[model samples]
Target: MAKTLLRSVGLFGAGMIAATLAPAIGAVDVGTYKELDQFMSVFERVRADYVDKVDDRTLIKGAIDGMLASLDPHSAYLDARDRQNMRTQTQGSYGGLGLSVTMEDGAVKIMTSQEDTPAAKAGLKTGDYITHLDGKLLYGGSLDEAVDQMRGKPGTRISLTVVRPGRDKPFDVSLTREVIQLKPVKWEVKNEVGIININTFVNSNTGDSVRAAIAGVQKSLGHDPLGYVIDLRSNPGGLLDQAIDVADIFLDRGEIVSQRGREKGDIERRYATATPTDLAHGLPIIVLVDAGSASAAEIVAGALQDQKRALVMGERSFGKGSVQTVLELSDDTALKLTTARYYTPSGRSVQEGGIKPDIIVPQLSDADYKARPRLREADLRRHLINEAKVDDKILEDDGKPDPRFQLTADGLKKQGIDDFQLDYAIKTIARMSQPPLRTALAGAKRGAK
Candidate 1:
C-alpha cells in the first residue's frame, strides 16, 4: 500500500538526514536534528510517493516560502519575477494600475492608489477589495499571481470587481493599463508657501527632487517662501538611504535614524550632514502624515519631529519600522529578510504605534474617511512585535471623534476646500510666516497718540 511505503521511506529518510547533518554541524543538537529529520522525511515521502509527480524546484520553493512565512509578513523568497518587479518599482516606472496592495484573508486588499494612476482615476479608494479580475474570481489566489494578472501591456483593459465597505453590493470597474510613472517628489507654491508632496521614497532621485522643488518654489516667488509643508500622506515607503538623504536636506545636524540588528552591538546609525545652509532656512515646516504613510516616509517624518525641525501634522503614520535586507541567493533568486528594527532619532520605534502627529488633522474632505476600516502593521498576520509593547487602548481610542475635526466633506466643499489636510497645513504655514498684528500696529498707535 502507498501508506506503508510512505511510512517506511519517512523512517529511512529521518535516519539518513541525521547521519548527513551530524558530520557537517559536528554534534548537531538533538532537538534541531529531530526537527530537520522530520522535514526531510516529509520531503522524501512527497518526492517518491505523491499521487502525481512534483518537481524538485516547486517543492524547494514551497519549503522556502513556508519557512519565510513563519517569520514575518514582510520576509519572503523573491523569485526572478518578484525581483524584477522590485527593481521596476524602485526605478519608479511600471506597467500596472499603480496600486499598493496587501494580502488579507486570501483576498487582495487595496492599501492606496497612487495619484493620477488608472486605479486612482477609476475611483478605487483605499480599503477596497479586488474580489475578481476580468470576471474571474481572484480570491483564494496568491497576491503575486493577482498582481501578475493585473500587470500587462500598456493600453490593455482589465475589469475589476470591487467590494468596498459601506457599499451594499460589489461594483465593476473597467480600467485601461498604462505606464505608472511615479513622481517621487512633487512641489507647488500655494498661498506663497512651498508644498512638497513626497509620494514615494523608492526612486533614486527622490532627495534631489526635493532639493529642486525647494529651488523651484524660491524661483517662483522671487524670495524665500513663508514655510514648507512636506505632504507624506498615503506614501508607502521604499529605500532607506533615500529617506536619510531627504531628512538630511532639511536638518543641519543630529541623528536621522538608527537601525538595530539581532545583537546588541549590531547597530547602525545615520546622521544628518553638517551643512552651513539650511535648505528651508529655518522656516517653519509641517510634515503631514496619515494612516497610509509608512517605512521611509515615517523615517523622514520621525527625524523632523524628533529634531524639532518640523511640526508633524495629520493622523498617525503606517507603522512599518522593521528594515528588510535583500540577500541575493542566485542570479534570479533572493531572500528578503526582516533584518532590523529602525528607530527614530529619539530612540522610538514606529512599529505598531506609528508617529503621532503634533497636530492631529483628520482628512475631513473624504466622505468615507470615518466609515472605512483602516489596515495597519498591527493588522497584518505574524507582524513583528514592538519591544516596547504598544498600548492597544491608545490605538483603539485614536479614532474617537475629536471636537477639533468638526468640518464635514459637504461643508468643506461648500467652502471650496477640496483637501482639508493640505489646506490646513498651508494656512498654518501662512500664519507662521506673518508677524503679529499687535506688533505691526504698535508703531501706528504710538504715532497717533
Candidate 2:
C-alpha cells in the first residue's frame, strides 16, 4: 500500500504539515499560523521588491532548493534536466561530455572526471570551475540548467569557459560530445591475481560485468586467479540496487545491506543469494576504496567487510550513507529525497563514519592525495548527524602524513611504480596466495646439531 511521506514546502509546508499532524487537527493555533503567514509575507515582498523581475518558476525552484538544503545535502529538486541526467547515469549510456559537477560559490565546480571521457581528456581537474557553457554564463543560474546545456547528441560540440585555480586567466576548451558508455567493471590479471576495477555502479549490469571479468581473467591466465582485488578508488557511487547486486556476486549467502527508513515497517533488507555460477569459488577477495568511494561504493565495501567475504583495504569511504529516493513530479521534474540511512549487515551505519578498511593503505604514489583535503559527509553542509559518538580524527583536518606510508610519489614514479594503494593490495594478495609454511609444517623443524 502507498503511504504518506514528508511533503516539500513551497507554501510553508512545515507549518502546514504540523497542523495536520498535531494531536488536535483543528486545534487552536497562533504561533504556527502566524509564522507561516510571516514567511509568505516575506516571500511576497521578495517577489515585489527585488531589484530585477524573477519568474515564478525561478522563485519556486529557489524556494524548493532552500527547503531541501535546510534538511540535508542529498535532498534536492531535480528539474527536467536533472531527472534525465539521473536516468542516463543509472541506465549507463548517454550522449554528452561525461563528467560530474556541482554548484559551489556561484560557479559550477567539476568533481572527478570519469576516466577516458572527454572531460578527463580535456584536462579538467577537480575543483575547476566552469563559469560558462557554450559561451553562455552559468553564474547566477541553477546548476541543473548548466547541466542541461552540457548534454547533447554525439558529434555536437560544447565550449566550456573554465576558471581553473592557480591559472592567471580563464580559458575556453571545446569538446565533442560522444555516447558516454561506461565499462563499469574492468579486470586484469596482476601478480597472478585478478584485479577488478569497478568504475561505477551506474550501469544496471554491473554484477554481470564483474562475473564476466573474473571468468575472463581466469581464462586468460590459464589458471585460477590467486584472488581478486575489487578496486573502488575514486568511484563516486550510483544506484543502491546495483551495489547490492554486485555485493551478492561473490557471496554464497548473507545479508548484503539494509536500510532503515523514517517510519516503522519501512526497513528493507537485501541478502546475498547463490548465483547461477559462483565462478569466483571461495577465492579470497580484497576490496579497495578511498575517500572518493561513496554511497553505492560504501554499500558494497561495508557489506563485504561485515560479512567477512572480503578484506576491505585502503582509506575509509566517502561516508555518503543516506539513501535518496527520486519521487517523480509533474513535467519530467522529480525530487531526490533523502529518506533513509543505510546500514551494513552488522547494523553499523556508514554516515559521518564511513566504512573503515580492515587494512588501511594510503595512496602513497599519488602526489596530489595529500595536498588535496578529502571531503566526507561530515564536511557537507547540514549533513545527517550520526547518533553514535565518533572520534575527532574522522572529521578533523590533520594534514600530517602517515608514518606507515612514507613512500614519495616522485621516487615511486622514478621506479616505474604508480598507484601505490593498488600496488600494496596486489602485494598483499600475492603473500596470501603463497602456500602455507607447511601443509602441517609437514612436521616440526628438528633442532640442528
Candidate 3:
C-alpha cells in the first residue's frame, strides 16, 4: 500500500495532490477523505473543549514535522530558521565559532573546527563534547537548538563549556562570532611529492586551489611532482558539482559519474570533457580515505578507481549514494528529500555498502578509538547487517584473493602501517621516476584504449 502511494506521489510530483483528488469526493473506498474529516472533527472538538487554548499554527507545524519524520532519515522538514542556516552553510559563510558539530549519546560534540576560525583559534579540539553554551545546559537538546544558540550576528560573543576527554573539569571558552569562509584545500610539497589535503568539496575555488597546489609542488621540486597524494581523511563530502569538477581535473576523457532514478529514462551521466592542466599525467596518484570520507568523496574514489586513474588507500568510504532535492514549502520552510540514488561508472551502489578501497589501510589508533568522538556513524547509530544472502563472496574472486592491489594497515600504533601508506605512496612516486610500475601503468592505459 505504501509503495502504491509512493508511486502515485511520484507520478503526481511529490507532495502534490492528484488531479482527480482536487475535487471533493462524495465517497471514497480508501477512507482518505474520511480520515481527514475525522482529524478535523477531532481538532474542532479540541478547540471547543480543551483545558486551554492551542495555536492552530502549532498544530499545523506538528503535523508537518510528523509527516516528514515518517519518511527516511535523510528526508527532513526544515523550518525557516533551518532553511536560512542551510543557505548559510551552502554559501560557505556563517556567523558563528565555525565548528562542525554532531550529537553523540545525547551530548553535542565538536567534529572539527574550521581552520583559522574562532573555534580553532580558541583551542577547541575535535574530540571535545560541548556541555553548555552561554551557561545554559546543552546536553539532551536538539542539534538544531544547539546550533541556534551558537549562531548569531557577526561580532556577537558566545561562551561554550566543553568536556575534553583528558581534562578533569569542563572548560569555558568565549569567542566572538565572525563570518567564516572555509577553504577546502591545503597542500605542501614533501620529498618532491605533492601532498594535498582536501578538507571538503564545497569551495568555489577548489579547482583553482588544486591547480595552485600542483604548481606549488612544481615550483618546490623544480619540476612537476613525481607523484601526488590526496588526503581525504575525515572529509565528509559536499557539493556534487564540485566533485565532478575535481574528477575532471585528473581524467582526460571518461564518464565521471551517473545518476539513475526509479523512473525510466531518468538516467543522467556526467563525463570529463577537459584535459588536465597539471604536468603529472602518468605520475603515481594515491588517494587517502577513511570512514569519515563520504558522498562526493565516494564518487571521486569510485570514479578514479573504475578508470584505474588512482590507487585508493585507507578504509572503506561512508556509503551515501542518495541525492537530495531541496523543495521550498509554502510557509517558508523547506524539505530536503532523497530523490535519487547515484551509481559509479562501474555500476556500483554506495548506499548501504560503500566503496571498498583498492588498498585497505587502517588509519585509526587506539587513542582515536578510545576517544569516542561523535562521528556520522554514532549520529546515525548505524548497525552492520549481514549481506551475505545478497552476495556471499562480493569481495571474493575465484576462491582466491584478488590481486588488483595490495591492502595493508599500520595497526593501532597510529604511526605504523597507516602512516606508512602515504610514505609508501611517495616512495612509489619516487620509484615511478624510474620503474617497472610506471611502465606497467602505461602499458595498462594503452591496453585500455
Winner by TM-score:
1
lDDT of 1 by residue, 187-278 (tens): 99988899999998888899999999999999999999889999999998888989999999998888999999999999999998887456
Query: What are the per-model C-alpha RMSD values against the true structure?
Result: 7.8, 5.9, 7.1
Task: List the candidates ranked by lDDT, beginning with the highest.
Answer: 1, 2, 3
Model 2 ranges with Cα > 4 A deviation: 1-32, 121-141, 145-178, 263-266, 274-278, 394-404, 437-449
Q: What is the lDDT of candidate 3?
A: 0.69
List, residue by residue over 1-449, the lDDT tens digit for candidate 3.
00000000122221133235556544445556556666666766776788989777666566666766675456667777776776566555777887888777789978677767899788786668999898999878899899878888999999898898865788899999998877788888878789988878755566677777777878888877778988776677777777877777777778888877769799989998765532456677888876677777888888887877888887666666767677665455667776777788888776656677777654333233434443433135442222322242363222444453233333324444435546666776687667777898878866765
Return whichever of 1 and 2 wins on TM-score. 1
The lowest-lDDT stretch of 10 consecutive residues in candidate 1 is: 1-10
Expressed as tens digits, the lDDT of each residue in 354-395 for candidate 2 is: 888888887777665655556677877789988675674754
lDDT of 3 at 344: 83
Provide the clash count, candidate 2.
Answer: 0
Error of 2 at 193 (Å): 1.6
TM-score attained by model 2: 0.81
Q: What local distance difference test score does each model get?
A: 0.86, 0.78, 0.69
